[model samples]
Target: MNLFSEIRGLVLDALAQMQSDGALPEGLSFVNVAVEPPRDAAHGDMATNAAMVLAKPAKMKPRDIADVLAGKLATDERITSAEVAGPGFLNLRLAPAVWQGVLAAVLEKDTDYGRSAMGQGQKVNVEYVSANPTGPLHVGHTRGAVFGDALASLLAYSGHDVTREYYINDGGAQVDVLARSAYERYREANGLSPEIAEGLYPGDYLIPIGEALKEKYGDSLIDKPESEWLEELREFSTEAMMDLIRADLKALGVEMDVFFSEKSLYGTGRIEAALKSLTDKGLIYEGVLEPPKGKKPEDWEPREQTLFKSTEHGDDVDRPVKKSDGSWTYFAPDIAYHYDKVTRGFDALIDVFGADHGGYVKRMKAAVSALSDGTVSLDIKLTQLVKLWKNGEPFKMSKRAGNFVTLRDVVDQVGPDVTRFVMLTRKNDAPLDFDFDKVLEQSRENPVFYVQYAHARVMSVLRRAAEAGIAADDATLTEADLGKIDHASELTVAKKLAEWPRLVEIAARTNEPHRVAFYLYELAGDFHALWNKGNDETQLRFIQDGDVATSQSKIALARAVSVVISAGLGILGVTPAQEMR
Candidate 1:
């Protein structure tokens, strides 16, 4: 149950009455009207802009409208008071039983409590961690992977049919580089002391690909020329790189629903089809783009070529689809890739890219918009850089991923759960510091442990209640007499618990999984505060020594906290610890 929505219904009902009674205009639209919790808790449970939004439209003063709406809202049984706040805002105070009922609702729904229908099962394609299939995934890709996967999960929980996709850059020069790199390793496996050229991949990861190539071809490709073995090696090397990438993602508990290859677009006429649609719409033309401001390339001579009029759709300039030499530009395949996604029947698309790909966002969004006739919405989230820290110093780099730390390196040090949770502790656009020393800490400073500890504490209570022969199953606990839970501290936790459903919708609406992490932190802090309060007041303790009825009622609250924590962690793809280790 969305309490905010329930209260919004009340506001609109009041406005309808005002219109019926002729106190307001006969034809006023409430599209801009909104009801939400005020920034400060003391302002009220929810505040509405009924007056502010309608004042000018109705040709009436805001206070005049708010005063009339307040009187109508006061008759709502759920609202204890309706007051006109500054400049026509209607602040509402719901009855204490309303908050109490919300907690009971959470207990009723259990793990499914916060699941939403906000998305209405819309099809959304989330493309993330589309790293070059040239080496193992690095730490930077880890953040994008976690954020994108969690976002896909969040969207699904909010009722969207989401497809987690990874676009493989397998059609470009990079795959050719992979083939050449593996050739060097293949020669090394033959004990030839192969020379590692300047442009070749020098990482030890290619050693396995070389060995695998041997096992498959058995030295048949050993003495072949570039043209003879390039295609075969490119295909083989890319598959091995993707295998390592998939394994790295699985280690961090990430999985994709689709792996789209750029190579497929090369021979499939998909690029021509996508650009043809644009050309039919007059979005494709032959043009020369202006040199970039202040730092034009030395070869900035104007040459007419096939270009997409991306500037009309907000790109900095018209983008080339084909170079003067007739080969497709790098962006040509990407546009076709996203066009392929749009044609797959997604109602919306979300691409999670590294911050370095920020310059590409506008053109990509433009492509999807053009391809889908502006019907499909594309939300591109760029995850910022991740700086690693260990033992109070910057974490060392990985030879596997060339210049950066690999995902396996991070997951190996702190395990998958910690790595995933820590990566999402910041917004996708906000740079994050992954400290190997801090994330493994058992204290509240570590969010993964803090949230997990709260779940473990609740489990501890349940185990104790079970050992004492107190029936604390959800069915029994839901029926417990919570009338005795009038303690201010206990009720404080109930208020926090009531925010779960609201928080989920908020996080999903914004595509911000970091909000979930922050919410869990706050929720755990509040639960911890209540637990610490039991030290001072004997009656505040969950177990009242010999009273099973009162203890069951109190333990019911603790059990509900665990239920919510477990569900929230589940959304984050983190397993709640049954006990602290």
Candidate 2:
């Protein structure tokens, strides 16, 4: 249950009653009123701006409104006390039974406790990790992957029908380069001295693709010209690289719901259709763009080109759709891809791009905005770079991935669970330094280990309770006399549990799954603190040797923690550790 929302409802009811009784002016809109946790817990359980928000509208002083509202809230059984802290903010103290009830709700709802209906099953498309199908995914793609996957899970948990999508960049000159590179590998497989050109992919990962080509073609096209095999090899090598990319993603526990090929947009009337839609809206036009601010005539020559009136939507400047030579610009296919998403009837779209693509964000949003006629919303999240550190030094490049470390390289050293959690330890837009040594150090500094340790500790308590024959299963715990859990330390954990539903809604609304990870870390810290406190206060111990009834009540609280932890980890695509290694 969302205690915060419930409390806010009570405050709103009090305000409505105040209006009815003429204690305040009528027709005062309570939309701006909010009830949330007080900034400092010492003040109260929750703080509301109901009085301050209504004072001016109600034509009364904030203190006068607060004084009356406080009396009204006092009549509610859930509110123990309501005091005006400062000028107008009302601090509320909830009854102890309210916190106890939160734990019971956690036990009752289990993994579904924090799930939200905020999205109302709206259709959403999340396109992410759309790396070119040229090589194995690198570290940058990993961050995008983790962020995108977690975001998709978060949206799904919040009741959105989310489609996880990957756009393949296979319709460009890069794939031709890939074909030429694979040809060299094929020659190498035929016992020839392959010329590893400077611009071609030189990674040894292509060796297997080369050998596979030899097995299929069997030297039939050994000396054929570029025209004879370029098309065939382009298709072949792109598929092979995609296969490798899929395997890499699988190793990291990522699977896309859709793999949209860039090639399909071309030669299929899709790009033309996308452009025509803009044309019909009078958005597409032939114009000359101004030369870039810092560029010289030698650097850039402005020419008349087919452009989209992106500025009309939100972009800083109009963007080109086609060049002076009548060839489509790089933005053309992307526009078509997003147009496809818009036409597919998604209510919202989210693109998880690398930080390097920051410049494209405004134009992409403009395109989607213009295409969807402002009906569908688009948010582009750029995941910043991740720097890998090992042994107090920058990690070296991977031989398998040629110039960069592959996603497999990181996953191999640390398991998928650790990889996912640590990747989200920082905001997606902030640079993250992932130290291999520090992540696996089994210390509190490592958030992944710390969260897992809390879950595992709860599991250990269950095992001990089971050994003591206290019947600590969920069924027994739900019926336990939770009033026995009256200690201050235990209540702190229950209060943290009460925030889960509110936290989920906030994180989902912000489209920031990193907030979920941060909450899990804080929750783990609270649980760990309570666990440690049990060490000094024998009565606070969960098992309470020889007292089955008191032990069941305490074990119920601990089990509730594991349930929420599992739900949070599930959103992050992390498996909650039942035992620490």
Candidate 3:
């Protein structure tokens, strides 16, 4: 029941009628036509650009087309007035009954009221928070985790078949370093002063991994050299660290559908297979890369290497797949991973990376393009840094993580709901300042609190109505004579509710879940404004004294607000507050 869509359909029907009456030319494309909310609410409920976009194409003046279109639209019962304004824009004021139907539709649909089929169930793989299994996840990974999880939920809400995935960096040299670090902790647990090397991980989180290693081996490998125990401990320590990471994510309410091991691509033909697929297309070659720009020739040395013709697919230059020493470069495994994703038959791929990885974006896209032959699209979203503040000062780092704040530290302090909601209050590409004091504040300045307070207020209304012996359930609310809701304040809320379905489609199309949070805040503002208005105006109050029918109609609108808030918060993985503490 999208009113904007319905109105757009009416506009299209009118344009077709105009063409049929020979007042307009035949065979004009209406793809550019759009129906959207007017920039100024005081102007109209909705606006359309059909006449403006078609004017030049139809060889007619925009105002002339708008005048004729307005006449056609005025015939519809839903549109109270269609005024041609500003060259060719058509602003429309919908009848009060149209807004009433929006409220009823919200009650009938419940949480699914704004769900959209724009994605059409296309398979999309969202890979995020693929941090190295070295220690607990920090504040940076927290933002990515929250953003990715919310994006996956948003896509699923809009009818995309989404797979939440984590690519483990367990096969790299970093894991070997982790093993040595854990070995030091093992010696410390065995009553020996361990040598804490400069390059070893210094976090106390590995102390348990070391103790676990001691329990498994029982000092047999304690005195052995690196060659004998390195491989065994590497595998064991990575598993332990991954367990810690999983627990951290669980505490933050994130669960991945798949955890891909980077080690799986090793000791197998996967890397070779991925490169061979590219080599078959004449993309692989051995060549000497030109020295990087702005360096003296004497300071730079050229080495022959196995490279992929990434330039053919939009990269700045051809990229090396294998170094002169014959080991695969970092780009090799990345190509193999994306090739694996393409082979899995996903219609699209989305990777959530930290902002530091911005330089890797184009090369990755090039690899996926070459692998899928432009059949699959890859969208990479980079989440910027999060600066934490508390009590007007920078927040202290977590002792457990050694140098950075852990995800659990933030979640434990504010709980998961606040942590997730606050993390997504900004665009992914923009840096976010998360102040602990401000987030916990219960004022309207705090978005999480404001949105939750709105839900809680609606719950309070439902409870009050229930205690007064009024039937306010969905079935009863749906049967209410909604025509009784004619107040301006009440209609303001209904107009906001009508934007939900359209906003859902917009957020999903742009792959931005923060838009949901923003919309919820605006909706809450409208609802709260109307609630405040009832204090002075007796008839504007939701529960009209001694009038059951009118009260039910008003209560119906309040419940509809809660329904949309719950759905929006659900997409953001925030549980709506039943009551504010």
Candidate 4:
């Protein structure tokens, strides 16, 4: 069904035949031979680097190889022309029936047409939005959540077994802080003036958690000692905050396959086990880390503490896994969590963190690398900041969140579909400016609307065809004579449609889901352009008055556009609009 792949296979077959006949040198590697869309449409349908890549290896000039390869490639039934351009790159033009066949293939396969087997069932663990389970998730966490979820879905579409995970920071002092913050609310629920003290959570969102605590514990525990209540309350409050977080993720349609607890690693000997694996490999030692260059850290003390020789594995400075007081350091639990993943038999681990956590990437990778003895790879993807815009200014802070815009605040304003698509319009490492006005604008300038409009317009055509008493059903459209689609514009769209399978492999190989968003935008644009061209040329119109057969063929093209749009939007976790409102 992939025309580009079919063409590439033909090219490889021709090269192999050349070697067998001694027309070219034997044992020449064709690994670098690629068939992809040329940068300029005027050049050809696809361009290949077979000749250029094999020239030096074969001990021949690029042009000499290109000339010989071109003579052999020109004989393929699908290849109408194979011309060497610019000293070795071969630009290929295919027969019109080739693109027509692609459109028919899309109709046959529907949305699953572009699904690829490139990942080969490798298990990839994606850890994202590991925000502290303290309160409502904010805008920064929103971006990371969307990016990680989309990337997981993209990898799954390309045949990777992806596990979406979140690591809770419940083992730290922050949850203790959350417990104390909720205690004040517990007192307030009993009709006492709650003291919102410094270093305590001041957000109004905790008011409900406090009220819930009173409903559960009432008057009996009101005057209890801190020693008796701290542990119980900490556990209760952390669970409550995680419930709030789960609700937020649900609001955005992000579901995690695992929610790992940092607390579990404590008292379970997991930290010791993780560090022992490193120590057994001579990567752990008791040493004082050299203070970061030219600056005194706030926690800098001359005392020797237990440290991991992280610098030996590529960190800037050796990191401590135990503090001076002999308690496990924050990095200890993280290392254990990752070691746990490695032990789970995952082939790769991808951690999605906020931009502020960029400094931790190197050490985290080093830990996984050393622990797995170079067998497993860890990729830490940092999602940069999302600047919110509304009323032509920044969407100001939320009192409920205490410091930033809660995920609910963003989703409630624009709905989940807009929020998800607009968040992915930028690269993961690049800052994205999301404007409330722009995302909702019903014009081509807005990619969110543009993509949906393309789908909705296709539905409009189907609806009209139905009203005209024409059979636009899949049964009819699937059997329509696509050769009747003869406009240059129609063929251009079919050619773009043929690139879907190729595009999926490219996006998965680079671990970049933004490419999917970008492709959807371009596809939507091309579709919109073709739709507009029908205004001047009635021959290209979706509905040909009084000719049901021709209308069915054009409707087949429109339905195929919907198939691709739905597939692309499914990967993004956004619903494709069937009717624009």
Candidate 5:
């Protein structure tokens, strides 16, 4: 249950009662009223802006309304005290039983404690890590992959029907370059000195594709000109690179529900269909375009071209769909891709692009808006750069990936759990520094370790209890007399647990998975603080000697902490540690 929601309901009900009793005016909107954790724990368990938000609307002083609201709330058994603090804000201290109920709810719900119905099963398409199939996924794509994957999970947990998708950039010149690069590797495999062209991909990853090509075709395509083998090699090499990318993502526990190829849009008449839909709405036009504003391109010149009136939706300027040369611009395929997504009947579309694509956001959003007639919403999240560090120096690039650090490079250094957790420690829009040494370090500074350590500590408690022949399973904890969990330090953990459901809803609303990471870290800190307190206070310990009843009651709280942590970590695509090695 969402304790904050319940308390807010209590406040709203009291406000309605005040109006019924003629203590307040009728027809006051409670839309702006909010119940949230106080900024300072010293203030109280929770705080409400009911009086403050209602004061001016009701033509009454905030303190006067707060005083009346406090009296109404004080009658509730759950609220131990409702003190009007500051000018009008009401701070509430809940009874100990309420916190205990939170722990019991956690044990009953287990990993599903924070699962929400916020999305209401809305169909959401999350497209991410749509890297070119010319090479293995690099560190930049790794961040996007982790962010998108975690976001999909978070949305699904919140009741969205999420589809994880990857858009392959195989219909571009980059794939042509990949083919030529693999052709060179094929020559090398055929016992010939190959020419390593400057424009072609130079990664050693294509060597295997080349060897496979040699084994398949032998010397038949060796003497053939570029025309014959180019198309074949393009298809073959793109698939090979995709395989490498899939493995890289699999290593990090990322799996996509769909792998959409951009090439399919080219010959399949999909691009024309998408453009025609826009044309029907008079969005498509043949017009002369102006040079870019400010410092224009050196080749900038006025030319007649097919353009979309993107500015009519939200873009800064009308964008060209076809160049003056009568060929589709790079953006044409993207528009078709999004149009296809819209026609698939998704309620919302989320694209996770690299930070370098920040300029492309508004135009793409406008395109989706135009295509879907604003029926479907599109949210584009740009994942910022990731800087790798090792030994206090910038980490070097992967030779396998030629000039960039592949996703495998980071995942190999630390396992998938650490990699996934660390990637989300920062917001998707924030630049992250992935230090190999620091991430592996078992300290509070390392969020992944700190959170995992908390889960592991809880497991350790369960193991110790089991070894002592005490029943401490979730079933047992659910039946435990949680009233025995009255210690202030233990209740502090329960209070933190009470915030999980609220935090999940907030994170899903903002489309920020980083908030989950932050919440998990804070919850871990609270649980660890209680664990530390138990060392000096005998009654605070999870296992009370010669008193299985008291020990089970207290261990119930500890197990509840693990339940929420596992759920939060699961949303982040992180497996909670059962034990620390």
Candidate 6:
């Protein structure tokens, strides 16, 4: 079903023939050979570099190799023409029937048309949106959540067993700060003027937490000192904040498969166990770290500490696991968390972190490498910032989230479909400017609208055909007179459809789901172009006036576009629009 892969196989078969004929040396590696779409569509459907890649290795001129390869390829019935272009590249154009088969395959496969097995069912753990459970998720966390969820879906579609997970940061000072802030709210609920400390959270979202605390503890915790209630309130308040966060993610259509707690790593020997695994390998030591670069020696003080030899793996310097005061540094729990993941037997690990955590990437990768003993691979994707705009002006912050916009706020304004699609319009590493005005517009300038409009247009065609008493179902379309679909405009859409399976594998390999969005936009553009051509040429229209056979064939092509679009949108976690409002 993958025309490019099929063509590549033909090219390999031709090379093997050349080896058998003794026209080329035996046992030459063809791994570098590739068959891909030509840079310019007018040149050919696909271009191969087999001849060029094997020229020097086979001790022959590239043009000579291309000439023989082209002759061998031209013998195949599927390949109508194989011409040499440039230095040694072979351009191929497949028969119209071959493109027709692609459309029929689409009808047969439906949403699974572009699904790939490139991942080979490898077990992958994707950890994202591990925000501190202090309040509702904000705009920054929204981007990570969307990206990670979409990535997990993409990997799953490509045959990877993906686990979506979140790491709760409750075992930190931030949770204590949240407890103190809620305690102030509790005092306010008790009819007392509360002290709003400078560092305490000031958001009004915690008012309900305060009222709930009053209902449960009622005056028992009211008069107690800090030591008497801090721990209890910390546990209670973190659970409340996590519930709020879960609701926020649910609004955005995100569901985590696992929610791991940082507190669990404490009160257990997990941290010691992870470090001991490294220490047994001579990676742990006690030493004084050199003063950081670009700082004066007098301004920096070096202290002896327990460190991990992260440099042995890939980090720029050794990292501290325990401070001079003997408390675990932040890196200790992180190492333990990754060690736990490796011990769980996942083949790969992917962490989606905010761009601010860019500095931690190297150390984290080093820790995973050391823990897994190079048996597991870790890929950390850092989602950059998202700047919101409305009416060509900077969007103001939300009072509910205190100083930032909450994910719920964005979803409430534009709904989850638009929110998810617009967030992924850019790559994870690039900063995105999400304009509320532009995203809601119905024009083609909006990618989400354009893609959805294409799907809706296909639905309209099917409905019109149905009303006209023409059978447009897949069962009928699969046996339709597809030879009637010989127009250049119709074949152009089929060509685009042929690229879907290839694009899916490419996107999955690069771990970039934005490529799917981009491809969907391009496919929509091609479909829209074909739709517009029908306005002038009655034969190009999908619904023929009196010919059911031709109408079925054309409608089949349009439906195929929708099938791929729906699959791509599904990977992005965006619902397809059945009709545009």
Tell me each candidate's TM-score.
0.97, 0.99, 0.99, 0.97, 0.98, 0.99
Q: What tens digits encode model 2's per-residue C-alpha lDDT throughout 305-414?
A: 99999999999999999999889999999999999999999999999999999999999999999999999999999999999999999999999878999899999999
Report, for every candidate in turn, its global Cα lDDT versus the true structure.
Answer: 0.88, 0.94, 0.94, 0.90, 0.93, 0.93
lDDT of 3 by residue, 323-415 (tens): 999999999998999999999999999999999999999899999999999999999999999999999999999888889999999998999
What lDDT is obtained when candidate 3 is compared to the true structure?
0.94
Q: Residue-wise lDDT of candidate 4 within 460-501, one digit each (tens)?
A: 999999899999988789899888987888888888889888
The residue-by-residue lDDT of candidate 1 on 1-581, one tens digit each, is 87777778888888999999999988899988888868887887788998999999899999999999999989878888999988889898877777667667878899898889999999999999999999889889999999999898898999999999999999889889889999888887876676788888889999988888778877777777899989999999999899999999999899998999989998889999999999999999987777788898987888889999887777777789999999999999999998888888999999998898889988987888899889999999999999999888999888776777899999999998898889889998999998898998999899989998999999898999989999989999888888877787887788788788888999999999988889889889989999999988889888889999999988988888888888888888898889997
Give lDDT tens digits, candidate 6, residues 58-176: 88999999999999999999999999998999999989999999999999999998888889999999999999999889999999999999999999999899999999998889999
**Residue pairs in collision within model 6:** none
Task: Give the higher-lDDT candidate: 1 or 3.
Answer: 3
Worst 10 residues of 1 by lDDT: 94-103
User: To one decimal, what is the Cα RMSD in angstroms of model 5 from the true structure?
Assistant: 1.1
Q: State each model's C-alpha RMSD to the native.
A: 1.6, 1.0, 1.1, 1.4, 1.1, 1.0
Worst 10 residues of 5 by lDDT: 287-296
Clashing pairs in 3: none
Clashes of each: 0, 0, 0, 0, 0, 0
Name the weakest run of 10 consecutive residues (lDDT summed) in model 2.
Answer: 293-302
Better model by lDDT: candidate 3 vs candidate 5:
3
Which candidate do you rate higher for lDDT, 1 or 2? 2
